[model samples]
Target: MAEPTDTAKTEQVLTEGNEAGVPRRDEERLKKWFIGSIDQGTTSTRFLIFDGTGTPIASHQLEFKQIYLHSGWIDHDPVEIVQTVETCIEEATKEFTKQGHSTSDIKAIGLSTQRETTVLWDIETGDLLHNAIAWPDTRTHAIVHELKNRKGADKLQDICGLPLSTYPSSVKLIWMLRNVDKVKKAYDEGRLAFGTIDTWLLFNLNGKERKLHVTDVTNASRTMFVNLHKLEYDSTVLDFFQLDPQKLKLPKIVPCSDPNAFGSMASGPLKGVKITGCLGDQSAALVGQLGFSPGMAKNTYGTGCFLLYNVGEKPVISHHGLLATVGYHFGGQRKPVYALEGSIAVAGSAVQFLRNNFKFIEASPDINDLAATVKDNGGCVFVTAFSGLFAPYWIDDAKGTIFGITQFTERGHIARATMEATCFQTKAILDAMEKDSGHKLAQLAVDGGMSNSDLCMQTQADLIGIPVDRPVMRETTSLGAAIAAGFAVDIWKEFDELKEINKEDRTIFKPQMTTGQSNGMYKRWERAVEMSKGWVDDSDDIPPSS
Candidate 1:
């Protein structure tokens, strides 16, 4: 949507405030009260505007270029990620202002970013020392290998509830320190500032002023620096990487809401807005889904896959390879909740690979139609190891593989198998989640791009042998961030008020596939995953077949 003419905006903003259908405080203030959400994801950037009840009124989205200078090296132009993000925030709010709302309505801004993407910038100049090394970047593979080589590899799982894998930010930070010329210079000059996309945006968003750098607990855990128990950077972990603590400004790790944890939005269509909430994308999606109670869980199928199970009040370190992360930490809730997280590195992006690379399908949803052509996969199984397996199997070097192919295995069969890959991986992660939490996931609340496909939802429910719930609104990540900001700005009095927000407009898929078929299909998936093991590529090549 384009900007409204000045007169039109004046009339619309006023008209919306005058609606008699509801009783909103300070109709004049409500006219100016909007929430801004900046959602930075693996492949794209999006900005959304929300009214008080957790619905997106307007949004703008853009996809950025991913750089793969080497087979394992994935990067993003830091400048592009920064600039595009700001532009989207402006554009989305412009749309809202045009349609009976005003920029001033945005009382607070919340942030949700792709976890584990590392950035290093100069404090003095505020310039990126290197491209934003993305979460999928594999340049840290060797660093993880070296860390594990030291005698204490097994001890990390107990401390962090995670194994040595390239997915974590610790190895990524170390790789930059040892390899990047600019990072070394900054370190020596006492000008180094390290952060994920969150810190990068925070610095830039605050006009590079006061260096108001911080990360929510959810993002911090992805970096190996944070001691899960203390919520501070681990001295031993920092020493292991040989990073100078004094030289770099460690962002104050804070909860997701209210005054202490934040700074205000300096400029945009929503200029002068006080900024207050932050979460890594997946965690925000959980909050958006309103999975506040224990036993409630959500799985988002976006560029990658993430499952978060709400474990109330205290952290539950996983015995399995699953990660222990902060579920939500709002000012309204005195006690913080925890989650057992399982990440699979490929999901909707797997279909994008087929559509863009091999020319298997022109439109993504066509894969859904084509896959449904057959009742089941024709003994074909696609193992999506694009960035290697995550959770349960943290194989850094493993690449993609496909097995059980025969002459009967047509494109339709392969397409069906690809979709099944996501379902199968979710099942594996869910099994581990249940094992570690000792709490069975009853019905999974799901959102994101792939959840739009009915077939995929049924497949996910059937494979896991549980019902899958899909909400009317697909963009839960943004909604989650909005919830945090709302709490910070006092748009709602308490966390319990959020429960009244309707989710009854949902579709629930129940398991119909017999247990034998589900187990038998899953066993084939296991074998395919086994074949994908130890398949690493050191040279530049196409990302492994999804």
Candidate 2:
């Protein structure tokens, strides 16, 4: 099998052409040696080199600086993200040289990034107007709340398959235009440039001279501005916020993984290598974990816990709080498959709060061991609302609240309960997915940093009453990029042929808790969630951007 490339699915044909869809150079000059997977996330950026089988031959990673301008504000320097990505590629290629291989084998590259973070800048100057406003930033909560009351707010959920919340890009972009100095003035002057992370990186990576401005279908769907059916930026949504479609620059929506959508790296050691695949972090993790068929599911434990269940073809408008999302437009599927996703705002970061905020634990892993020390929760259950609840119950007003603290409750119990908080939310999401899709989860394919925990996996299994499968390689997010990159360059002919590439020792946790125990514990979790709503007052009276 061959490797995956950085091309979008739209660019996967054996034939090649330039941005104008015309052949500017020899199509055969496009190297077919390596595919680079650039995994850009909330905290860090990485560059991975892969072969035909979706295996990582070499990789490098670097964490970037995060700026919190104000409380509830989260931002990233687009320049920093691009530079770190370059450094990662350089470092990885240096390591590759140490392994007695030249960087020449690199064929294509794929990118999976933190979704909904927006970057505004001058199309000519190549300078960012402001830091990237992350999806979780609460600075826009004011606008979110204001819109929640308006008549169109109720209709937004049906059209976009997403609730009118701070998590999406539409509101965040609106907030930037209204609150920021340059963003507002520039938009008024029609000089503003806007893009999600992938678009920003693609423009930076390809060359500032000829802006490579196109967003993959998967990322565009999350922005709320894009019409879910037409897969283009909607004028109605633009008008709802009283914004100018002309000033707010949006990239063309294209397929998820193709070799030529955004050409290869132009400045890195792998400069000539073409990028062929791109996806948001969670979507890439799904594809990387090989959730190819319908009924396939995975829960990525990141800053937030995102649970996705693949539902094949044509979007199923989710009745529940879950978002109807594109599984992938591999540019090969009969039609793009969709997913019912339950996104939780808090997951692994809850443990981080215990370490940095509460000073309860010395390190992150200590929480896990401390959790395992306690046989059970000791009647303590934690509702991780550090960022409020998501999916099934879109309680934007909730804050992190720990409940049922008793005389016997200790750090160990809290630790276990903290981990269980993730599991419980995950179970709720899976339950919601099952309800909406009418498909009970047979098993869960797990990846990401937290899935390494045997205790957490077992807890997830017990709560969800399904088998939890932890892949051998936790880097499935990057590997998925590799897979798409390889597929585009004809290194791998089909998905099944590449299945054995990342095979490793597996861990499977089967449901052990009895139905009665599961029910009673879940009921307690429900009560805890109800109590959590008062943290901010979920009543519609809360101020927008509150």
Candidate 3:
């Protein structure tokens, strides 16, 4: 008889077990199992359904309203966020089932959300007390200033691995307690419930019958309430913030990937599906990129840009201004891995600015085509500090400024400058990460909305002088969540198995600019960044409404 062909072998592996003698039951489970990921981001919420091999089979995305109450104040409706998530899950799962698959095939779900966005509600009635405070909102700037000057405030970094800033949930929560009457009333009555987006979604998804209030370590780490060393809420920090344990209803911090911690969906097309994973959006992107070991790093360019450099099991406090965060904890016997993260407050939002503020283009994708029209930035440099600079600089005083513009400048020049601004900031963050981690990045695994721009990726490669690897599936944020959920259900038994999935046909952008040229451009960018600072010297510039 002729030897079996490759197709026959593949068919045999699909129908029967391979030479490893895997049981038929296991094979059938593997064949039918599907994982779902809810990627709740700053500007949008998306749900993606993936098979056992990590390939997204069905997905749905909804762009929700971003409420900007004031210049630097941002908020989102808590109810809207929850409703949008439910809608996405229902729609995506419907498509999955419509494709001849059963809802039972979706064995597990994972959640990835924008970290540090705080929501407060009533524990008994589940009524949202106020709109969700977005991470980028600077309403807590005064509170942060007060905390910074208070006694023992300086020691917060040592305890929580984070400095007092407007970015964390602790500060946002404090702001709400002091400003919002409803929140204060709830706190006084011992009914105030506090959580990030993940916690809020989990609570609502589990339904009114049995509300589950919990958060993953990755999301909890950004809140400034959890101690990096202890992996739980620290009493000392709580004392410093003057938050009484008797009054506050904080969620329990659980492992990033757990089958039981995040409860099943109470209703929807994916009703009763187990939630096995929860991660901050950036951390989820890192896991989705399979950056499981030390020295591996990934950049996610969503509403903002975040670079996470994995530093292995132990947390390394950044002496270089980066935030130390829990990367992910795969529940079982494994320890949680830590990472050094650098956040850029603006990335794709700069592109959105062009569309919404400047009307430079009708849509975001038009930016790439328009930007490519110009050979370079045309002697223009844009400092995209719309909500101030984050990471190494931390110049909250800076405002968005475009310098080097002349009468000859065109829209293309501004577009190019906008793209370059993000690239320059990313390079700055990478430099800080290198200094902090003592490891040089050979390549960067990138994903998110802005990463879709080949022009932007090429610019990033040229500026950083490293290969930029982008996978065919640019939705790694959702993919990461799916991977975590799949891990819990044994759809993916080991990390080594993920290496074979989603590994084919990657796009690599190589550096094309000379070192001297790149350096010259970056120096000009630095000067522009410096010039943009102190633009808002008057305290009145940021009104009390924020």
Point to the candidate with the largest TM-score.
3
Q: Runs in model 2 with CA error above 4 Å?
A: 1-33, 332-334, 537-546
Residue lDDT tens for model 3, 1-546? 999753343345444645764422233434556788999999999999887667788999999999998778999998999889989988998888889998866778989999999999999898889999999887676677778899999889888888777789999999889989999999999999999999999999999558678999999999998999889999999999999989999999999888799999888887788899999999999999999989999998888999999999999988888899999999899899999999999999999999999999999989999999989999999998877788878777788999998999999999999998889999999999889877789999999889999999999999999999999988888889988887776666568666755678999999999999999999999999889988655455655574
Q: Is candidate 1 or candidate 3 better by lDDT?
A: 3
Candidate with the larger lDDT of 2 and 3 = 3
TM-score computed on alpha carbons, candidate 1: 0.91
- Per-residue alpha-carbon lDDT of model 2 for 2-21, expressed as tens digits? 66443433244322544555
How well is each residue in 1-546 modelled by candidate 1, as lDDT tens digits? Answer: 999753344345434556572323334434355678889998899999877666678999999998879766789887888888888988887788789776655677888999889999888888779887888777777678778888767677656655678888778878888889989889888888888888788777877866777888888877878877776788777776677788866677888876546677677666667678888899899999988888789999999899999888777888777888778778454777788898888898889988998899988878888888898889999998888888778888778788889987888888888889999989999999888888788789999988988999999988999999999888899988888877776665455656745476799999999999899999988988888887674564466688
lDDT of 3 at 332: 91
Better of 1 and 3 by TM-score: 3
Could you arrange the candidates by TM-score from highest to lowest? Answer: 3, 1, 2
Q: What TM-score would every model get versus the actual structure?
A: 0.91, 0.90, 0.94
